[model samples]
Target chain A: MPETETFVSKIFIAGSIDAVWREITKTDEPQGAMFNNRMHTDGLALGGQIRMRTPDGKYTGVIGEILEFDPPHRFAHTFRFTHLEDAECVVSYDLKEVDGGVEFTLTSKGVAVGSKTAKQMKSGGGFICKTLKAIVEKGRLPLHVWTIYHVLKALSFMAPAATKSENWPLKGNGDAQPA
Target chain B: MKTDSFDSIFQALAHPARRRMLDIVKDTPGCNVNDVAAAFEMTRIGVMKHLAKLEEAGLIHSEKSGRDRRLYFNIVPIQLIYDRWTMEYSGWWAGRMVDIKYAIEAGTNPQEPDA
Candidate 1:
């Protein structure tokens, strides 16, 4: 087997197992904010397909076959985005009860070792874990939402310019401050 | 999106020498290469290589004036990275809260009328 890197994040939500499972598997926008890209899926069952669109309107679809299904406890699936023909990763969600709430563990594996995607996923996993914890504890979206939106907007501007020039002033870490 | 940008940033910061250089500039802005080199035990040329990597990652900026080039830390890129990830996770949490609210309501009023 080839060496692969994995990213794991766990969140404890004040909810029941069934409710948490439903939120993770179902709930699409403009109904819920779980996935912004407007996922089109049949259901959370074996051999189900999942697809998501980029904020820029680009589409990446994946075939998600359930590998493990333990009601209200665990769900695992194999995912492959359309752009990554040679890459197929496994994402699993494990739920457990603790102190009148549920602990959700999200794990992604089979990412290419030492690859850029793996690094981003690792950083993203940490940030997501922290943000999820904050939301659950405070019971509200963060006030810095607009700051985040603008950051993404800036990236959209700089990404194309980066390909053109090596010394572009816009090129830097993803955490660039907005101009 | 060009995902490689994030990788290059991390890769540039992967080295301890580069990270230390960043920390120094962040603490004391407008420090020249010689000033940064004095803090490290490595030779001046060795430190320059690390600074070059950081400059490439856009973590630091340098400007030459007269005989010295002053280096300043740029923190905007790091901030952008933090914002994007935070928003996505926050969205997930909001969805989870909705499900929880419904579950709690349903559990409390099994006999009550559904509205």
Candidate 2:
């Protein structure tokens, strides 16, 4: 069996801690920083369930339970992507107030080395942090991200009905919906 | 990202040994100082110094795991630098491309009345 590893990514966003936290925990709309994944959660509390779904509610990408929910500071969850066949990993977001802005950090553990999920997380971590920082600080996304978001929006109609939000409830059979 | 942070990041990455140390830590997460030092012919203190520089640049962070300190690379500072360049230049080029595409279409069509 491959050994597990921990990955950490951090960013300095020129914004208040509250702004950074809001972007991370935003549930009402799609977060462009998260590749247009709209967070759907039962509530913002410990032990509640959360999932990242498409903007049109047509597909679900990630599903996990909240492990920590400290407001404006720390939020941790067991992240398991629906598309990858890997063990659930712990992902935590830590926001600290700095001199002129917030220092946002993302840490993940229990990722098997060289796994597909690990590869994705390694690359995804940087882009996510960068996009989140840009969104919180500049109020916009990079041009490539903007173009990808629109393309995903345009392709939403091709999503399968089985993957729609209505099919995946907050309390499901303790298994991820296959992508 | 601040100017000094870039200075530190680039400086830390300037040395071939430091960059190799970074790659080791990045490729092997949770690796310790000794694990990184073993790969080098330099003295342990020398490796420590390079690790310190990398840590100072926010390129790697360490946590005490029992008796050993585990090191993991942090990609945020580099990502910030990347976004800084791409966002400014890419946005400009994308806008220009759109304008040029429209110009080409308009010039070739000659069908629609001029606004």
Candidate 3:
């Protein structure tokens, strides 16, 4: 049976439209972190293709031509995750000026109903929105950054095992019996 | 291990309904299933499913009292996850910046001219 799901997320970023655009459309740099790849496209205009590349030169998605484009206001496009059949979806971004920033809404439609990808799209969408907000407001990576920090802290405490030498003295060496 | 934990947290948070539920609970304490369901266009069962996911993710907790199952926010785990993920990336960026600074001081372009 065919299933369908939709996810929407909104965030208020305290920055100008140009700044947001640069971050949103960046092909390289930290802004690419949210997409997990560099967006390789000429522009984000109507009928303009939005493509992204993996570090290994693999094509992740062949984003359809932009359906809508309004600078600092809105952008919409169709996305096809190349490796997954029936993984076609529409992504739209609506931006509005708020008291201290811009309120942006990201909507994804046509996700397969009850599929793992849909479930993930729902939650991951929100995280990405929040992460973008944090980035715009604080100029930082936010949640992913925090996750990495804690993991390193935990690993730092366990690095002793890797530094251990095979010839290291055993405890109570003087009293140790011959093997 | 950390990446797995991070992935789980992200997976749990991927849902829009679940995130909205978290915000509701965070703003108001002791909200029941019905109250949460009322906030959305989805059916009670739909909301309950979202709640179940939230509960499983440790983002929220629930208890029953007098035929009412009250859900409360548990934001600590989210904060912990955020701290873990954000810090790692930031550290990497910091190291790169340091390298860039050293390169500039040596009268060379810090970044590779072209990839």
Candidate 4:
């Protein structure tokens, strides 16, 4: 196989596995841990399409296809950023019940070496893990994150109309369709 | 999150050797113990000890990939520390730093020399 990089981030969340799983897989509201992006999906099924959009629904940041969707344990997807021009990468989440709480691990594979996606993935993984821990343990986002959420929501109107969820429907093939 | 306070992270980062070890692991993702040990003149056991401390602080995560354990530097702890200290003001500071850089590149010298 060609050279590719993998990043793994693990966090011990002081909460139940179900809670952690719910936070990661929530599709109804914006996920504060994930930059306040509300996940839009047909359902949690293998090969199903997925999209992460701004809370205000002005833009979609990421699109993916579900690879694995075992409840409360494993969830894997092929992630592709709508704005980035890189090949799709696989992201997986694993949750295990530990003594005090659940151990959550986020893994990304097939990342092109030294690509912009790699840089974003590296920085984003840590932020996601840290925010997820805080949200799960404290039941709220950090003050800074809360401020960012509001700022992002307020500025979402400036996002390109091509990124609207209506333009990128979840009925396409596994490949990301251009709007 | 594992009952570890910021003190643990600070202590892990206190030693220069440990900091260098972290850099090695970060530069070479999916590296193994031997790969890291080869970079330092210290004994393998000494390197392992430092790695242990880094792992204890959640700075490094190891996964068993075949017979060799793959080591990856985790940045969450450092990010958490950074987020704790800097808030919205940090963005303004960062913007100013970028502006200073551009001005310096253009020979504008926005800030006056220190007295």
Candidate 5:
């Protein structure tokens, strides 16, 4: 089998597996909280529909159907958007009970290596995992304080880039920062 | 949207050896093609071909002094990739949490539910 690329994010949730499972598999709740507002989904049965949208609407939404549903353990679904076109990918969550709580792993699979989707899926795993931890533990997520500073830097980078004397690339070691 | 530099950047970075070659050129700015390949115990011509690809990708440039060409890193294309890959995502990723702080601490009650 061709080894497909996957984006894996692991989070330790203090909540019980059932509670986390409810959060992941629950449907049709009032959609306004940090966890609830980001994604809206219909029934989560096999072939059920799901959609996730970024708050700013920059990425629009990824709409898809559930491909696997094993409550309190695994949930997976198809993921597609206007940006991704027809490249089919699956997003899955696997929950395992740990010492004090649950170890949650979110994975996005079937991404072709070196594609933009691959990059997004890779980085997105970190973002989503951190956001999930923040919401489950703290009741909501907050912008990483550093993110504000980086956003301005990013805008500057988009402009006519300066030469390397300015340390222009900013030289992050490709590790995901705390969210 | 793909840029012309995008493919070259990924292609140049596809191999661990090539990336190591770039690192060698980076530490020793005046390093020659043979110098990069020697670090990996590869043939000189083989390293020359690798450096050629790096040069093609705009990741490094060479200057001929006498008969030897000294290699120097040109990070513009790498910077472009960094801009596209990291900065672009950070913008929206931050936005995803814009209202989260307020949502959690919404009222006097600390244990308030997210409505």
Candidate 6:
């Protein structure tokens, strides 16, 4: 019967295994307001606490810990959002060398297939995987770049007719490219 | 774009107040310092500092029209940054990874894209 566990999501990260491994294991910081500015981790070693603070400054933090820690290959932890619900799952990051580069797969299970808990877990799981991909690949915050993009887009809307006609700062001919 | 220019663009965009000023400059092309400063709660000098940053970052085009300096929003740097980060990565994460693989095989390759 399709294995009794629930796996959330996965993605491929194109980078060296050493580089990818260093990024995932080196440091831990709060991923902005999503995690209530708190992703406290005692360490990445097996049995270390991996506290993920959910939204709300007053709500009690979820208490999860490192369950598996195999450096340069696998790192799994208790993915729980106790503050939101009794949501409990196992989030695993597996890095394997493939044809081009390393493929990082994030899997989370222990929640129902189509349940709200599953969705939340998937979102979080996807976020972690994407964050790793962005860091190892782009080497910057994707959201920050995305934010600048929207700001530029908003600014472009107010451009006068001449601004489009002139294309003053652009490199090539004045085709009036869209931002 | 050059990496230094890219860094300046991001550094200039790192402020919310500067972002708001950029919006004002966009809505009012050829707007003078005073015209842009009126929207912000800070002193005119403070506002000018932010405007100067945007100008330096190539995010705004400034013109000396008669007695006043008018500013217009420039989006080229932003577009290039978008292309570099999003367009380059949105697709071919692995296909581009293939390029990295070849780069690896080709030798230490001074342009190993971060190695």
The candidate maximizing lDDT is: 4
What's model 6's interface RMSD, roughly to a tenth of an angstrom?
17.2
lDDT string, candidate 4, A1-179, tens digits: 44789998877788888889999898767788889888877777997888898766658898999999999999999998887788999999999887788878899999998788988998888789888999989999988779888887778878766677677777634223222
DockQ winner between 2 and 5, please give it: 2
Position B83, candidate 6: lDDT: 49
Tell me model 2's lDDT, rounded to 2 decimals. Answer: 0.82
lDDT of 6 by residue, A76-148 (tens): 8876554344556677777877656676655665665556666676455545555566777777657754575
Model 5: lDDT to the true structure: 0.60
Candidate 5, residue A8: lDDT: 47
Lowest summed lDDT across 10 adjacent residues in model 6 chain B is found at B1-10
TM-score (0 to 1) for chain B of model 4: 0.79
Q: For all the predictions, what are the DockQ values?
A: 0.02, 0.32, 0.02, 0.45, 0.02, 0.01
Q: What are the runs in model 3 whose C-alpha is more than 4 Å off?
A: A28-30, A59-62, A146-179, B1-115
TM-score of chain B of 3: 0.67
lDDT of 2 by residue, A1-179 (tens): 44887888877778888988888898877787788798888777899898889866668888889999999899999998776678999999988887788877788889877788888888888889888877887898877789888997898777666556666677643223333
Give per-residue CA lDDT, model 4, range B8-113, as digits (tens): 8899999999999999998888899999999899999999999999988888888899999889888877866776777778868987998899888877776865
Candidate 1: regions farther than 4 A off: A30-35, A54-58, A61-63, A81-86, A135-137, A145-179, B1-115
TM-score of each: 0.45, 0.80, 0.49, 0.82, 0.45, 0.42
Candidate 3 per-residue lDDT over residues A1-179, each given as its tens digit: 43565565544467765667666666554243354444545555677665544332223433455789887678788876543455678888777675566755666777777665576666665666666766676777755556764564454434334222221222233112221
Count of backbone clashes for each model? Answer: 11, 0, 26, 0, 0, 1
Model 5: per-residue Cα lDDT over B1-115, one tens digit each: 1123368778988988899998987666566776777787778888888888877675775667699987766544554455455655685776556556565556533345545
Which ranges in model 6 have alpha carbons more than 4 Å from their true place?
Answer: A1-5, A28-38, A53-62, A144-179, B1-115
Q: RMSD for each model, in Å, please?
A: 21.9, 9.8, 22.0, 5.3, 20.9, 26.7
Clashes of 4: 0
Better of 4 and 6 by DockQ: 4
The residue-by-residue lDDT of candidate 1 on A127-154, one tens digit each, is 5444444445454445564366456545
User: Relative to the unseen true structure, what is the C-alpha lDDT of residue A92 in candidate 3, on a scale of 0 to 100?
Assistant: 81
Distance (Å) between predicted and true CA of B26, model 2? 1.9
Candidate 1 residue lDDT tens string, B30-50: 678988999999999999998
Error of 2 at B7 (Å): 1.0
